[model samples]
Target: MQASEVDYLIIGAGSAGSVLAGRLSEDPGTQVTLIEAGPADRSVLIHCPAGLALMAKSRQLNWGFETVPQPGLNGRRGYQPRGKVLGGSSSINAMIYMRGHRADYDAWAAEGNAGWSYEEVLPYFKRSEHNERGADAFHGTGGPLNVMDLRSPNPFGPRFVEAAKEAGFAANPDFNGAEQEGVGLYQVTHKNGERCSAAKAYLTPNLGRPNLQVRTGALVTRIVLEGRRAVGVELLEGGQTVTLRARREVLLCAGAFQSPQLLMLSGIGPADELRRHGIAVRHELPGVGAHLHDHPDVVLVYDLPGATDLFGLSLAGAARVWRGIGEWRRQRSGMLTTNFAEAGGFIKSDAAEPIPDLQLHFVIGKLVDHGRKTVFGHGFSCHVCVLRPRSRGSLRLASADPRAAPLIDPAFLQDPDDLRRMVLGFKQMRDILNRPALARFGGRELPASASARSDAEIETFIRNHADTIYHPVGTCRMGTGALDVVDTTLRVRGIEGLRVVDASVMPSVVGGNTNAPVIMIAEKAADLIRAQA
Candidate 1:
C-alpha cells in the first residue's frame, strides 16, 4: 500500500488496538489499518495454557523489556515481558480474565474523568465479554472477548481455596461476581481450552472485512504531525519508511510503556526532555510518561516434597505433562489447560480498609523470578500484591532511536504505606499456605521467605523480590488536571486527530488483571469516536 488514506489508522494491534480496528471498521464507509510491531500470534506456546512458563523465559514472543535498577527493589532490575504479538501482553500473559474492583473506575470519575464511573463503564465491560457461565446484569453474552472457566485446573487450586477458608477467608466462587472479597479458582480468557487473546477475539474474527487491514512487523517511528495536529504516522516496515495518512484519526493503542514513549518521540512530551534528547518539540505534554505504576507483587514459594499434582522439572513431571498434552489435544481438558495462576482472590490488607487492598494469586507451580529462573522440583507458590499502591514512577526516553527501550522506573515500594501493606499481605499469604487445610500439601517454605520472620525481615524480603505483576498503567493518565495527558474523550489534550485508548490512559492502575479493563476501555472508545462522526 502506498501513502494511503486510512479513515482510522490505529497503532499497535494489541488489546486496545484490535478492538478499535474491529469496531471502527464495522461500517463499510470507514477504512481502518491496524499496525503491529510484533509478528503474528501463531506460536503454539501462546495458545497452550501451560506454555506460559516457557514463554516467560524466552523473548521470542515478547518485547522482553527490563527496568532500570530500582532503588526500592534493592538496586535490582525488574523483568518486564510485554507481548510482541498481535494480542500484545494478553497473548503471552497468564490467561486470567479479571476486571478489577468497581471502585477503581469510580475513583477515576471522582478525579474528574466523566463517563468513567463504574456505573457508566459497566455497559462497555459487559459489551466486550461473553462469559461462559452465562450473562446477567453484570455480564453480557455474544461478545467478542471469550471469558470462561479453566478447562481442567489442578486439584491443588481447590486445596488453596480450602486453606484460605481455613485461614478465615470466605470461599467466593467468582471473583468478578457480585463481591470480590473471597478466594476461588479464576476464570480465564480462553475458548475451547485455547487462549482467546484480544487479537483472537476481536481482530481475527473481523479480518475478512473489506474495510479492515491488519499489518504485522510494523514499527511506528513517530506520529506525523503538521504544526499541532497529528494527521498520520511514519512507520518502519519492510525495511522502508512508510507514511500512512489518517483521514479521520490516528488512534494510539500502544501499552503503558510504549504509548508514552511514542508520544515523547513524536515531540509531544516535556520540552526540556525532548530538547536534551535532540528531538524537536512539537507540543509539550509534561505528563506523557508520568504517573507510571504497577501492582508490586511478592511470591512465596514452598518445596512440597510429596507433590504429584503440581508442575515441576523432574522426569515424572515431564511425563505427566507429555500425557496431558495428548489429553488436551483430544478432549480440550487436562493438566495442560492450567493457567498456572489458577486460583486467586481479593482481600483487604487491613480490616479498616474500605475495599480490598491486596490481591492473591495461588500458582500451581513454583514461580521464581517470574519463572525466568529454573526452580527444580515440585511445589506451589502464592503471590500477593498491593491493589492500590501510593507510589508513582515514570517512563522516559532512553535514546533518540525509536527502536531503543524506554527508561521504565516503576519506583516500586517507594511509598512507606505500600511497603507496610505488602508486609501485611505477606503474612496473610503465609498464613493461608500454612493453614491446617493445606498442611498436608505444605512443606518447608522457600529460603527467602523462610528467613523472613519479623516485619522488618518481610520488608527486606519484599524490597529484594517485589516486581510487577504485569499490570502497568497511568502513564498517559486521563483527567483534567495540569499534568493530565488525555481528556475524558480519550483524545490527547493538545493534539487533534489523535487519541489514546489503551491502559496507558487509565487515571490509576486497576486492582486486578488489566487485560479485561483495557478491552473495555477500547470498547467505549470506539463509541466515543464514532459518536462524533
Candidate 2:
C-alpha cells in the first residue's frame, strides 16, 4: 500500500478533532489531516437548534450504539448516541454551553493531573468562547465559539425557573457564573439563532488553509504502530484501504468509545483482552477502556394542555412549525430556534457536599427514552442525573473487525450510592415540578413517576427509567495511576508520537454538559503540542 504523510494525523473530525485540526494548521509549517467516519456537517438538522430535538436518533448524524444489557438498569440495553457528523455530538446536542463546576477541575488536579485545575484551565475556556454577554473576568467576547442567551426561549422556560423558586431554590441567571447551584436558563453555543458546533466555529472557517486537509467517510481500521509508538492510521475509504503516516504525531480525538476501541484494536490494551479478540498485543495498557462512566438520568414527564411552546406532532403543532419556518427565515428568531432543554441548573442534594452533585434539564417537550419513545399530546419534561457518578464501566472489542461496533457497557447505576442519589434527586425534581408556578399548566405525571412517592418506590422507578443523559467519558482517562491511559499532558503513558485529546481523557466526567469541556481540552492540547514543537 502506498502511504501518504502529514505532520499531524488526527482521527475523528468531531469536536476535539475539529479544534485540533484548525489550531495545529495555523502555522504554515504544520500540515494536519483530520479523518472523520461520518459525512460533513451540511444537513439542516445539524445547524438548526430545533433539529437537536430529534437529532439524537438520526443515523446519518449519530453513531447509534447500544449498551450490552446494563445490569444496573434491569437488563435493558441503553441507547448510546455519539455524533457521526463533522461536529460530533456538538452538532446534535442541546447547545447548552456549560463548563461544569470549578471543583470538577480541581479534583482532576488533585488526582495528579497538573495544570488541569479550574484556575489553570479557565483561560482555555475563555479563549474558545465568544460570549454575547461581552468580555468579563469570567467570559470572553471575540472567540470563535459563540455563546449567547436564547433569543427565543420557550415561555415555559421561565415558568420552570419560577417553579424552582416556589420549591425554595434561588433563581440563578447564570449557571456558568460565580456559582452553579440554583435554577436558571442555560446559555447555548449559538450564533444568530444557529447551532455553533465545533466544526462550524473551528474547522469551517479554516477550510481554505493550505496546511489543513479534512477527509470525511474515512473509517479508521487501526493505528499503525512501530513497536510502542503510533506512526499513522490505516483507514478504509470507499471500500479501499489507505495508510496515512504522521511525520510528527498521531492524535486520537475519537471521543470515549471509539478512542479506546481504536487503541485496543491496534493492540494497545490489556494483553489478555487483545488475545481474546484475536489481536496480538503491542502494548499492555490495562486502562485503555476501563474507566468508562456517564451521568445516569431519569426523566419526569408531564402532559401540558394548551402548550404552544413545546414541540408536538399534531396538526396544530405542525401548522405552528410551518409558520415558524417563515418567522425564522425573516427574523432568525422563533419557536424553531428552541433548544428544548432551555432551562436547568445544578443543586447540592446534601449540604455536606462541597459542590452540586445533581443537575436538572428542563426540556420544553415531553421526552421519554431520549425521545425515542413517542409520547402524544403537548407536554414538557425534566431530567435529573447524578453529576459525578461513582460507577464505572468498560468498552471492549466485540470483534476483530474494526467495522464492528465496540462492546459498550456503561454500567449505569451500578454503584448503589448512585441509585440512592438518583432517588434523592428524583424527589427534588418532583418537588419543583409540583410547585404552583407550573400547576396552572394542567399537567399530570406519567405512571412511572405519578405514584412513586416513597424512597423504595422511587428507587424502583430509577432502576427502570434511568439511562444516559448523553455524556459518556473516562474510558481513556488521563492521570498518573497504573490504570491511567494518558499522563497530565495527554500523551499516552507507554507510547510515543501519540496523544488522546477528547472527552475520554477526562479522568472524571465534569459536572455538566461535556461539549464545552471537550473543546477546552483540545484548546489546551493544541498549546501543549505547539510548546513541544
Candidate 3:
C-alpha cells in the first residue's frame, strides 16, 4: 500500500472541500490533499443549467441514495440524490444563490455557535460572491464564484412574480439582501450561462499549484485515530487500501449523511450503538447522527392551457432547441440557460412570525417525481417547502463494515406542526397559482380531485407525495451543547486535529439553498485552521 503525507487531508471534494483545498493551498506553504469518492466533473450536462433534471438520476454524477421507509410518509421510501463529483451538489443543483434568512444565522449564534451570526458571517458571504450587479453593501465585487441574474428568464417567470403580487405578495429583487419576504427571480451561481461550480470557482484556477493534490476516485473509508487524535485517513484507491497522513488535521467534508456515518464507523458516536456494531470506541459522543433534518417539498403540478412549456421540446421538437441554442450561443442569453424555477418567494405560514418560514420555488415546466422518466409537457409546478422543520431524523451505522451504506431515516412530517405548516404552504401555492394572473395560462392538475378547501385533504396529499428538496442538515450539529458533534469552531468533539467543514455542522438548517452557505463555512473554517496553524 502506498503511503503519503499532507498538511491537510480533506475527505469529500464537494462544495466545502474544494474551497478548503483552494484557500489552504494558496500560501504555497501548506500541502493539501482532497479525496473525492466520485469521478471528475467533466460532463457537459453538468454545465448546462436546464440539464440538471437529466442528471438527477444519473449514477455517474449522483450517489442515488434512498431513505429507509418512513412511517410518517405512509411507509414510502424517499429518494435522495447527492452529488458525487468534485463540485458536489453545487455542480448538480439548480444554481440558486440563496443565503437563507438573517434570523437563520442569528439562531445559530443564539444557540452557542459564536461568530456564526448573520452580521458576523455576512462578510464571508460577500467574500465568495462576484455578483453581476456589481459591488454593494450586501454583495461582493471580486470573487471566484459568479452570482448573476438570469439573462433571458423563462417567459412565465415574470408572470409568476406578478402572480405572487396579484395574490398579495411583494416582488423582491434580492432574497439575499435586506429581506426575504417576497417573490422574484433567484440569483444563480453562473458565469455567462455556464455553471460556476465550486471546483470551477476555487479548485480549477489553483489546480496547477504544487501544494494542492486533488485525487478523484479516492473513497475514504475511515479516519485513522490515535488516542482521540485524528492523524490520517484510510481510503480505497484503485482497489487497494492506502494510508494518507495529515500532519495538521483531517477534515470531514463528506456532507451530512456520510459525515455522521463515518464518525459512527470510527467509534465516535453513541457508545451503545458502537458496541452493537462491534466497533471499538474512540469517543463516546452521543450526537453523531442526532438532530437530523431535511426540507420536505410538495410539488403542485398544473397543466398549461397552451403549448408554452419547455417540455414540448422533445427530440422531435428540434426547432425550439435549435432556436434556444442559437440564442445562447450567439449572445450568452436564452431560456435554455436558466433554471426554470426562475421565480419564487418566502412567506410566513402564521401571521405572528416576524420572518417567513415557508419557501416557494416556482418552475415553468411540469416536473413529476424527481424528474426521472416521467412524462412532462406544457405545464408548470410550484414547490412549497417549510424552510425550518421541527421534525428530526437520524443516521445510524447499519453495520461496522466500511463498505456498507448507513441507514438514513429523515422522518419527514413526523410532527403535526410540520404537516400543518406544509398544508398551509400548499394552500399558499394554490392561492398564487389560481390567481387571475396565472389562470390565463395554467389550470389545476394534482389535488384537483380532492377539494382544495379542506386541510385534511391537503395534509393527506402532503404525506403521500412530499419529498425532500435535497436540503438535509443538523445531523452533526455544532455548538457548545452536550450533544454537539463538533464545537463552534467546527472541531469534532472529543477529538483533536479533526474538524467537520460541511452542512452537517449546521446547528440548524438555513432557510434556503445550502450550497453557498456550505462554501462560506469552508471559507471560515479555512481561516480558523490557518490561524491555528
The worst-scoring run of ten residues by lDDT in candidate 2 lies at 1-10
State the lDDT of candidate 2 residue by residue for 1-533, as single tens digits.
12389889999988899999989999998899999999999998877788877786688899999999988988999999999989998988989999999999999999899999999999999999999988888888888899999998888889999999998889998887888899999999999988999999999999998888999999999999998788999999999999999999999999999999999999999898999989999999999999899999999999886686688767788889999888887888998888899998888787788889999999998898888877777888999999999999999989989989999998898889999888888998998998998988788998878988889888888888889998999989999989999998899988999999999999999999999999999999999999988
| Lowest-sum lDDT 10-residue window in model 1 | 1-10
Better of 2 and 3 by lDDT: 2
lDDT of 3 by residue, 1-533 (tens): 11399899999988999999999999888899999999999987787777786876798998878899988888999988889998998888888999999999999999878899999999999998899898888999788899999877877878888889998899999999888899999999889888899988999999899888989998888999989899999989899999999999999999999999988887789999999999988889998999889998998888764555444435544567678777776776776787877889998888887899999998877778878757645678889998999899999888988767788888999988888889888888888888887888647675542355688777777888888999999889999988888998899987999999999999888999899999999999989999999
Q: What is the lDDT of residue 351 in candidate 3?
A: 82
**Candidate 2 runs further than 4 Å off:** 1-3
Off by over 4 Å in 3: 1-3, 313-318, 325-332, 447-452
- Model 1, span 203-296: residue lDDT tens: 9888888888888999999999998888999999999998999989999998999999999999999898899899999999999999999999
**Cα error, candidate 3, residue 135 (Å):** 1.4
Error of 2 at 167 (Å): 0.9
Query: What TM-score should be assigned to candidate 1?
Result: 0.99
Deviation from native of the Cα of residue 251 in model 3, angstroms: 0.8
TM-score of each: 0.99, 0.98, 0.97
